[model samples]
Target chain A: AQSVTQPDIHITVSEGASLELRCNYSYGATPYLFWYVQSPGQGLQLLLKYFSGDTLVQGIKGFEAEFKRSQSSFNLRKPSVHWSDAAEYFCGGDNQGGKLIFGQGTELSVKP
Target chain B: DVKVTQSSRYLVKRTGEKVFLECVQDMDHENMFWYRQDPGLGLRLIYFSYDVKMKEKGDIPEGYSVSREKKERFSLILESASTNQTSMYLCASSYPDSYQPQHFGDGTRLSIL
Candidate 1:
């Protein structure tokens, strides 16, 4: 079965610090990868997505993700974290089926 | 912006009662999905509809049914509510392309008593 895995359940980082959230997936083929963030009392928003070429994809809110086919990982990263960036992050994959398979999710805490 | 609206932000229902969760999308997307979010299990797709009067079962659709009588509306139905059915339900819509990303609603947090 196709699956996505976000190893970290919760991560804490000080404001202005760099942030990196890891994600891995298992699938028959390298599917379309995506990163979404859900803030408190708000809906989930698409951060970025990787469809084809250019392993490094930039997204909204100063976020970027790199797709590594060798490791089957699509990790999200930010050079500097902000207080408002604290939220729940999810990694997902679409096998060209219009259905998304999402990871459990990582709750990020930005401390000042 | 693509606006996908869920009828309720929160809901409470009694066991054995029929329950309905309504969703509407203004983007005129060809695909709509209903997913249940659980703390450690992530989001599980219950059902999806691609067109008017067309529906398909998702991974965890055993206890749920869906209706899409119109182009912009999709409804999820629980035949008999149960405590285990309590969850954060999310509604999303997207274009027909498999690679198209979906736009979501603010989710309905339903509690079954």
Candidate 2:
């Protein structure tokens, strides 16, 4: 069975500051990793995904993640975060049939 | 763009009432999934359908049942609503062979009283 862990439950960052959300997964083989964001009362939006390729994958809204197989981590990062970026972010690993094992999610609070 | 539609945005049901949550995807994807979202728990899969009339139990499927009557429609059923079952329900659809992202609906927030 595959599982994902996000240690940070909540993170607060000032506007224009760099931010990183940690994510680690336990999977037997090469895993498909994804980052998704959800605003209050809204559905989740895909930030980015890593199937196989470059270690660093860029995503929407100035977000990027690096897949580190050695660390079993795919952490999301942004150089600058805006107030609109305040939302809950989730990291997930894809199992067979595209079933996703999601982390507990990290709620990001961007202060102005 | 893939459009997954959940039938309700908000629902209020009494305990012990039978509840049905409907989902429809327009992309003709081969896989559809039902998940429940709660604060601090993220999203937990309730059930999924790989093909029409084929269902599979997910990580948390004990309190829920699912049906996939058509290729584009998948439904989640609660035989008897309970307070613990009250949560935001989400429906998503994805292709079988493609690594394409799962498209989600706006979600239905069900409250059991």
Candidate 3:
């Protein structure tokens, strides 16, 4: 079975601090990976995606994620955190077609 | 930019009532999907359509049905809504290629009374 896992249910970081959200995927082979952010009462917004090219993929809102083949991980990172960046983040993987399996999600809280 | 729109942002319906959630995508993508989201569960695929009039069941499709009469439009119907069925419904579209990322709608928060 293909699945995505985000170990942290929630994380708190002070504004200007660096952030990292861990994600692990289980699949038979390499899969398409993605990170999405959702604000309160709003829809999900794509943060970044990794298909096949570079290991490091850049996304919107100054976010990036690195795909590690050996670790089976696609961890999201941001050098500096902003208050507006506080939101629930989801990690997803697709091995076949366009169907995606998503993790439970990690809620990030940035304190000023 | 790709745009996926849902018919409602908030909906309130009674149990045993028929409910319809409409979604439209302007991207002309070949794949469209319906998902239901809940706390701690993230998102679960309900149904998906790869072409007009073609639909496939996702992880959870027991009480739900879908229609894709037109290429750009997909509808998710609840035959008999239940309290446990209340959730945030999301629609998404993407190219048929497996590598392409999906674009999402603002979502519809439906409540069963």
- DockQ each candidate and list the results: 0.78, 0.67, 0.85
For model 1, what TM-score does chain A reach?
Answer: 0.98
At residue B97, give the lDDT of candidate 2: 53
How much is A76 displaced in model 1, in angstroms? 0.1
TM-score of chain A of each: 0.98, 0.97, 0.98
Fnat of every candidate, listed in order: 0.69, 0.51, 0.80
List the TM-score for candidate 1's chain B.
0.98
Candidate 1 docks at the CAPRI level of medium
Poorest stretch of ten by lDDT in candidate 3 chain B: B96-105
Off by over 4 Å in 3: none
Q: How many angstroms is the interface RMSD of candidate 2? A: 1.4
* lDDT of model number 3: 0.95
TM-score-best of 2 and 3: 3
Score residue A41 of candidate 2 by CA lDDT.
86
- Predicted model with the maximum lDDT: 3
Model 1 spans > 4 angstroms off: none
**Candidate 1 lDDT over residue span A1-112, tens digit each:** 8999999999999999999999999999999999999998677899999999999999999999999999999999999999999999999999857999999999999999
Candidate 3, residue A22: Cα displacement in angstroms equals 0.7
Instruction: Rank candidates by lDDT, best first.
Output: 3, 1, 2
